[model samples]
Target chain A: AQTIHQWPVAEIKAVGSPLSLGCTIKGKSSPNLYWYWQATGGTLQQLFYSITVGQVESVVQLNLSASRPKDDQFILSTEKLLLSHSGFYLCAWSLDRNYAEQFFGPGTRLTVL
Target chain B: SQWGEENLQALSIQEGEDVTMNCSYKTYTTVVHWYRQDSGRGPALIILIRSNEREKRSGRLRATLDTSSQSSSLSITAAQCEDTAVYFCATGYGNEKITFGAGTKLTIKP
Candidate 1:
């Protein structure tokens, strides 16, 4: 079975600190990976998506970026965090192209204090 | 683009009762995905019903899709307190990316 794994289930950092969250897909190759953020009120927002290695697209700019270094790995990182960055971060993956039922990982909740 | 929109932003029901959630979308889609999100967790795919199909059932949950009107509905039979969660409808218009709508918060009173 294909499973998506995200690390650092929860994080707390002061403003201007660096942030990095990761997602890994097991048992699948070349899957489409996505990063999403849910605000405190639970509004789903798309942040970034990657189709393949070395290519990531930003749907909404937040002074943060994503990188797909390998086929099964996608990373979300920020050099300086803002208070607005605090939220629940989620990583999701879909199968091949058009026929994809997106599967989500556990998720990482970040608190910018 | 709000491709899929769900009605009944919140619902509260007694255990063992049947409840239905409705969703409507603006664009043409080949499939509609239903998701359930527990508090503090990522949304998980509960049901995926395609356009060619009218209705699909999984255990006690049933989902119906109507491509003609760009709408779909999910019904949960014999609800339990564990089923209390936010439900979302996502529309995939042949695009790999699925756009999710604001979810419906369902509370089951056990």
Candidate 2:
């Protein structure tokens, strides 16, 4: 079985503060990683996706960046957080392709004030 | 019906009632994914229908895909209180990213 874990389950940050969130997947090798953001009671928006280590693709630009530094780890970070950046951040993985069914992690709740 | 940019649709029904949510996409896609999202949690896949197939069923859930009409539908039979959640239909092209609908919020009253 595969398990995905996200760090800092919840956070409250001020505007202009730097932020970093991390996700790690276990029991799967070379799985495709993806990042998604969802507003409270709003629809999900895809942020970034990675097919391999060190090669991340941006699906939408929201002043946030994601990197896969290791095969099992993905990091989402920003230099400055904005009020609109506050939302639920989800990390998902699929087997080798974007079209495959994706499994998501527990997710991180962020609040910007 | 639900799609991109539309307001989130809401549906309320009594327990044991059958309900169906519909979604339409604009662009071409090879697969349609149905996901259920609980409060404060990530969306979980419930059913996936491919362009090659018209309908698929799992347990009490049924999913249908109409490639010609560019739409898909998810039906829940004998709904329970625990079945209350927001349902989203996402279209996935073979070579591109997946596009999610605005979602339908369903409330099952016991």
Candidate 3:
């Protein structure tokens, strides 16, 4: 069975600080990866998606960027954090991008102050 | 925006009761996915209904998709306290990206 792992289960950062979050998927090769963010009592918004290594697509511009450096690794980072960047960030993967069901990893809770 | 203006908000029910949540989309979609998100956890797909199928069932959960109305509904039978969570409807328009609606918070009272 495939398993997904996310690093830094939770983080609290001040405004203007830098931030980085990571996700890794094991047991599955060449899977589609996605990043989603949800604010407190808000909808889950798609941030970015990658179909292959070294390429990523932006779904919504939240001043964040994502990179799939390895087949099983995805990273989300920002140089300067804003107060509005606080939310729960989720990492998801699907077998393919053809409307397949997505599996999620234990998310990272971010608090910006 | 694909989501309707009115948010599905919240629903409360007693144990063993049945509840249904509805969603409406703006554009055409080939698949509708239902997901459940527990507090502090990422949303997990619970059901997926295709456009060709009007309704699909799994255990105590049922999902209905209506292409004509551009809407979908998910129903849970004999609800339990563990069922308390936020339910979201996601639509994929034959693309790599899927859009999620503002979820409906369901609270099951024991």
Candidate ranking under lDDT, highest first, comes to 3, 2, 1
Docking class of 3: medium
Candidate 2 residue-wise lDDT, A1-113, digit = tens: 99999988999999999999999999999999999999988888888989899999998899999999999999999999999999999999999955888898999999999
lDDT of 3 by residue, B49-87 (tens): 999999999999999999999999999999999999999
> Each candidate's iRMS in angstroms?
2.2, 1.3, 1.2
State the lDDT at A96 in candidate 3. Answer: 75
* A40-83: candidate 1 lDDT, tens digit per residue: 65557778888889999888799999999999999999999999
Which 10 residues in a row give candidate 1 chain A its minimum summed lDDT?
A: A38-47
Query: Candidate 1, clashing residue pairs?
Result: none
Chain A TM-score values for every predicted structure, listed in order: 0.96, 0.98, 0.98
Ranking by TM-score: 3, 2, 1
Error of 3 at A42 (Å): 1.5
Q: How well is candidate 2 docked (DockQ)?
A: 0.73
Stretch of 10 with least lDDT, candidate 3 chain A: A95-104
Per TM-score, the best of the predicted structures is 3
- Among all candidates shown, the one with the greatest DockQ: 3
Top of the candidates by lDDT: 3
Across B31-82, the per-residue lDDT of candidate 2 in tens digits comes to 8999999998889999999899999999999999998888899999999999
